[model samples]
Target: MTRDHSKTFYFGSRFFPLPQRQAVWAVYAACRVGDDIVDEPGGGPVVLSDWWARVQSALTGRVAFSQAGPHPVDLALGWAAGQFPIPVSAFQELYLGLRMDLEGQVYRDMDDLELYCRRVAGVVGFMIAPICGYSGGDRTLEYALRLGQAMQLTNILRDVGEDLARGRLYLPESLLNEYGVTPAMLEAAEVTPEYCALMRHLTALARTWYAEGRAGIPQLQGSGRLAVTAAARAYEGILDALERNGYDNFRRRASVSGTRKLLMLPQAWWEMKLG
Candidate 1:
């Protein structure tokens, strides 16, 4: 699933030992299922709500589907939760984030946007921290949150045009107003100086978070540190690709090439070893 949906992440996961790699795959698959439902045209509030309920049932061992004996993704995730210290609260918060998407909620400011990012992405970091061998540290969790936000911000920037087509804008309204970039401008796929400036500002913010997140990399144990560092570098590479293209996200999608991803591995290994 990771290979199909996220090659960068799939590449990074290879650094982990078998158990951790499988656990990450399980978690990723479970998250992907929810994401797919929300992204589907026919998926509505009822569908999202039902999906959340089924996830809740699966997490609690209630078994939502008897004949099928539980969803395969959920079964793997349930095992992962038992083996690791997966927090149910994080999953609940993720569901709430999905709810926000279903309601077509718009962010009024950075605070609102950050809240959405935290619920949708930060919680995943928290959930994965224990699996990565980091436990019971507020500092580690804070780093996880920062990294998740950084990655999500990158996603928001990269998908700006795509999201606008869906009648959704992850960028904050206040920022748009401040930059004198209107919704119509974005809707029309305008790439004016003001829009470019706005994107630069957002990209800088993401870079800051990425740096802060990297500062906590040494805190992770075993091969998880290498996996995370690789993932971070690969994701950050997208930001670099965007900048290199003059932030023309509408005309083309920003992506890190496979060769570039391969280049990151050795550096990631060195960083892990040095730390």
Candidate 2:
């Protein structure tokens, strides 16, 4: 699932030992299932509740996943939960974020959007941190949370044009007003100077989170540290690609080629060693 849906994670998890790698895949697949529920056509509270029930059944072992219940994603999650101290609260928060998307909530400001990012993505860090066995505890988890937010922000920036086409906007209204960019401009796919400035502002914020997240890398155990470093490097490469594309996200999608990802591995490995 990771390889199919998320090339960056698939590339980075190559460094993990078998157990951690599989656990990571399990978590990702489960998250994907939730996202699919919100993203797929005709999904709503009814089906969303059903999905949540299955997840709860899996995580708490309230029902036998194999005997008459649970999706494959939940089954995988059940196994991962048994093996590690997976944070149930993280999943709970994630479901709320899915609910937000289902309700078509709009972003009012950075705080609102950051809260969405934390619930939807940052909690993913909380879920994975225990599997990797961090040394600094909450401190490491905090950084992990920041990394997830940074990645989500990158997703927002990269998908601006696509989201606009879908009649959805992730950019905060406050920021748009401050930058003097109108909804008409965005709808017209105009990369005006103000829009470019707005993109630059958010890009810098994501980069700041990336830097902070990287500082916590050495706190992770075993190959997970290198794995995370590689993931961070590969993911941040997208930002560089966006800059190179002149932030013309409305017309040009920013992506790091597979070769570029491979090239990043050596430097990532070196950084892991240096740490």
Residue pairs with backbone atoms closer than 3 Å in model 1 (clashes): none
Off by over 4 Å in 1: none
Each model's number of backbone clashes? 0, 0
Instruction: Kindly list the per-residue Cα lDDT of model 1 for residues 52-120, writing each as its tens digit.
Output: 887776667664776857778878887787788777788899999988888899899999999988888
Candidate 1, TM-score vs. the true structure? 0.96
Candidate that would win on lDDT: 2
Q: What value does the lDDT take at residue 41 in candidate 1?
A: 75
The TM-scores of all predictions, comma-separated, are 0.96, 0.95
Residue range 126-173, candidate 2, lDDT tens digits: 988888889987898999999998888888899899877767788999
- Model 1 clash number: 0
Weakest ten-residue segment in model 2 by summed lDDT: 61-70
RMSD of each: 1.4, 1.6
lDDT of every model, 2 decimals:
0.86, 0.88
